[model samples]
Target: MHNRYSLKEMFFEHLTRFSAILVLFFLSAIFIVLIIKAYPAIHHFGFSFITEQKWAPNFELFGGLPAIYGSFISTLIAMLFAIPVAIGIAIFLSEIAPKSLKSPIGVSIELLAAIPSVVYGMWGLFYLAPFMRDVFGGNGLGLFTAGLILAIMILPFISAITRDALNTTPKILKESAYALGATQWDVIKDIMIPYAKAGIVGSVILALGRAFGETMAVTFVMGNAHQIPSSIFEPATSIPSTLANEFSEVDSELYLSSLYLLALILFIISFIIIAFAKFYFLKNRVKRKKRLV
Candidate 1:
């Protein structure tokens, strides 16, 4: 029976190792494929493809700056709006909310994440866009509107993950803090947040990553305008939105390749952001843990 258990453990270890390797293999494959498909545009446009804002296919001129700018700005806006709200929701649900209210509120928040992206797009287009236009004084569709929609779409994810993180804090720690005459805010700020900082950071990064890649939800409100937006209320395009809008309409090889290059650029951006968070942030975390040990 001991031998049987050992064999089962060994098998499980090998299976999990294989799964990790498989994920790496898939990531590498996608990068390789994107590079291959985007090579022509890379070679033709050189580095200017990233800096130029023009995207007129009629003139066969393609530049990714507008899309890149829009993507980053929209994501920035989303993170700005979502992070604080998400953290507040997490704190409320984990620490402040009464048990009777927690279940209903938690379920409603989680339900937001279950809604389809296209549904968000529709709602943003018809409802949110008009509201923004009326309130902020711009055409219905623009970066600000898109960013707001992205914030709402990503809120549930960030809140849920952060709530779980905050919940992981020990009851004993809170009790001790209270016993020491610490106020609720003091315990939360000094004890709970410090203890769960890693998870909180992870949740924010996850939401940021999702906001970067959000396509449909952004597309409806962003207007897919291929130009550098002069204002937050001005219409603009993002990488994913550009790809979604023009992929099927490309009439030439260069057009297609440029779109592929845009995809590659987006892939690189997301990979770099996530890799930095995982490697730099998490490595520092490990080093700190070792020092503590």
Candidate 2:
């Protein structure tokens, strides 16, 4: 029996190690491919590939400034709208919901994440765009509309992760706070949030990552205009949206390479954001541990 248990443990350990290695292998492969494919545009356009604002492919000029600007603005708008609502929902679900209602509510929230991106795009294009047009004007397909759709799409992800983080708070800490005559809000604001700060930050970063890379929904409602948006109501294009719209139609090698370079830029941006989040989380965690000690 002892020998069998040892063999079983060894098998599982090797399996897990292999899985981790496989993931690293795939990531390295993708990074290498992006560097190779994007080299032409990077070499030809140099720094201007990212700095220049015009994307006149007919004249063999391509610039990612507008797409990058659109991506940042749209993500900012989405986070502005999403963060408060997501936090509220997370707080309610984790701390306030009755036992009988919690399961159903959680499931419903998660169901939003399960919906296909294309379905969200279709709904945004057909329903939300018209509503926006009538109420806020500008043909409705623009940065604001895209941001709204992205907010809705990322809401479930942020809320679910936040709720999970909140749920992990120690029960004894809450009980002690309650015994000290602290109100529910005080407990949540002081104990729960601080204890789960790292996880909450992680959730927000994950949501931001999702918002940044989102393609289909943003494409459908973003109007695909390859120019910097002067206003939230003006048409714009994001990096993902640009790639989705033009990847198939490009006839020039430079244009194709430029698109790959855009993809590489996006990958680098995401990697940097994730790395920052991880560093921040670790630093805070260490500080908290020292405080506890």
Candidate 3:
């Protein structure tokens, strides 16, 4: 019964939908291409490629287990360090920060994320590596240093998102908590954290994805060793770093394909993690709505 959109408005709306479909199709096409190119490695190594850790060029043997493990462990360490700090920052920004201090501080934290990845790597190499060596009393490059750098890189991401998530909490919820005689800490620990848990987790997943895929920062600090690390202080390699270091020199087609397969694996891992995060977000959103009702 209302006035319909003009011809240009209708055309623009359809264009937007079609553009989104095209973007999805393009992404699918790229995935297919990468898989096809990587088929040789998958066929040659079978599933053992994922499990076997040795990556020797002399015997023409290769596997990504070590690299994958490094990526996982480094990112996990980053999470252990980043999550608490990011949460603290978020909590302060959302509830405890003075009105005058909030904007400047938030902007500064986000500016950290805006720094170039290469710049982070260079700093990791020159500045962070030396600091780690001085503090930890060992070699400059190791899983720990890589992880520390990754944490610095991922912190801003999680903190910014978490702050936004917490800020989005309904004012009525805070009022209700106050009416119930809940202390500020109690309200935050119970009402606030639980309500924003889903979004915080989504932010974490995104940060973890960045950690797993990070190349320059990790590579500069990881010592670029392909062997399995015995401790967090030991030098190691990650899948992305391995590819970045060696893909250009992979003389054989099988070697090249194997590298591409590693990319595929990373892509799949990220997709699954993000999907889980999305599931958590949607589940919590429903739960939050029900609680309101």
Candidate 4:
């Protein structure tokens, strides 16, 4: 029995290590390919490719500023709308829901996350875009619409992670707070949130990453206008949306390389955000541990 257990553990350990190596290999390959493919545009355009606003491919004037601006604004809008609603849902599901309803609600939210991005895109294009245009005015297919769609798409991921984090709190903590005459809101605000702050922050970062890289859904509604949006209601194009819309049609090597550069930029931004979140979480955790000691 001892020998069998040891063999099983060794097998799994090796399997896990193999999986990790495979993932690392793939990530390195992607980064290398992007760098190689994007070098032409980088060499030709230099810093202006990212700084200038115009994207007139016909005029050989290509810049990523508008796409980058659109991506940031849309992601900001999504985070603003999604974060509060996700937290509320997570709180209700984890702390307030009745036992009978909790599982169903949680499952429903998870199901939402499982829906494909293209389906969301179709729904947004057919149903949501028209609603926005008819009701609010403007073209409707713009930054605001893209942001709204992304918010809905990312909500389930944030909420599910937050719910799990909140659920990890010790029951004793809540009971002790209650014994101390603390209200439910007080317990949640002061104790629960602080306890799960790192996990919550991580979840937000993940959601932001998703919002930033989202392609199909944003493409359907973002109007694919390669210009800086003057307002939320104006048409715009995100990096992902631009790549999706133009990658197939690119006849110029420079244009193709520029798209690759955009991909690299998106990847770098996500990596930086995740790295920052991890650093912040670790620093806070160390501070808390010192306080406890």
Model 4: CA > 4 A from native: 1-20, 278-293
Candidate 4 weakest ten by summed lDDT: 273-282
**Each candidate's TM vs. the true structure?**
0.89, 0.89, 0.90, 0.89
lDDT of 3 by residue, 12-112 (tens): 99999999999899989979988998899899999999998898866678898989999999999999999999999999998999999999999999998
Clashing pairs in 4: none
Candidate 4 lands at a TM-score of 0.89
Please report the TM-score between candidate 3 and the true structure.
Answer: 0.90
What are the per-residue Cα lDDT tens digits for candidate 4 across 1-111?
999999999999999999999999999999999999999989989998889899988977789999999999999999999999999999999889999999999999999
Model 1: per-residue Cα lDDT over 1-293, one tens digit each: 99999999999999999999999999999999999989999999999999998988999899999999999999999998999999999899988999999989999999989999999999999999999889888787888898999999999998998898788889999999999999999999999898888778877887787889889999998988999878999899999999999999889999999999999989888887777657745876887799999
Alpha carbon lDDT of each predicted model: 0.90, 0.92, 0.89, 0.92
Superposed Cα deviation of residue 198, candidate 2 (Å): 0.9
Model 2 C-alpha lDDT per residue in residues 1-293, reported as the tens digit of each score: 99999999999999999999999999999899999999999999999888899999999999999999999999999999999999999999988999999989999999989999989999999999999999988899899999999999999998998898899999999999999999999999999998887888887997898889999989999999999878889889999999999999999999999999999999989888888778877898798889999
RMSD of each: 3.6, 3.5, 3.3, 3.7
Alpha-carbon deviation at 279 in model 4, angstroms: 4.4
Model 2, stretches more than 4 Å misplaced? Answer: 1-22, 280-293
Show the colliding residue pairs in model 3.
none
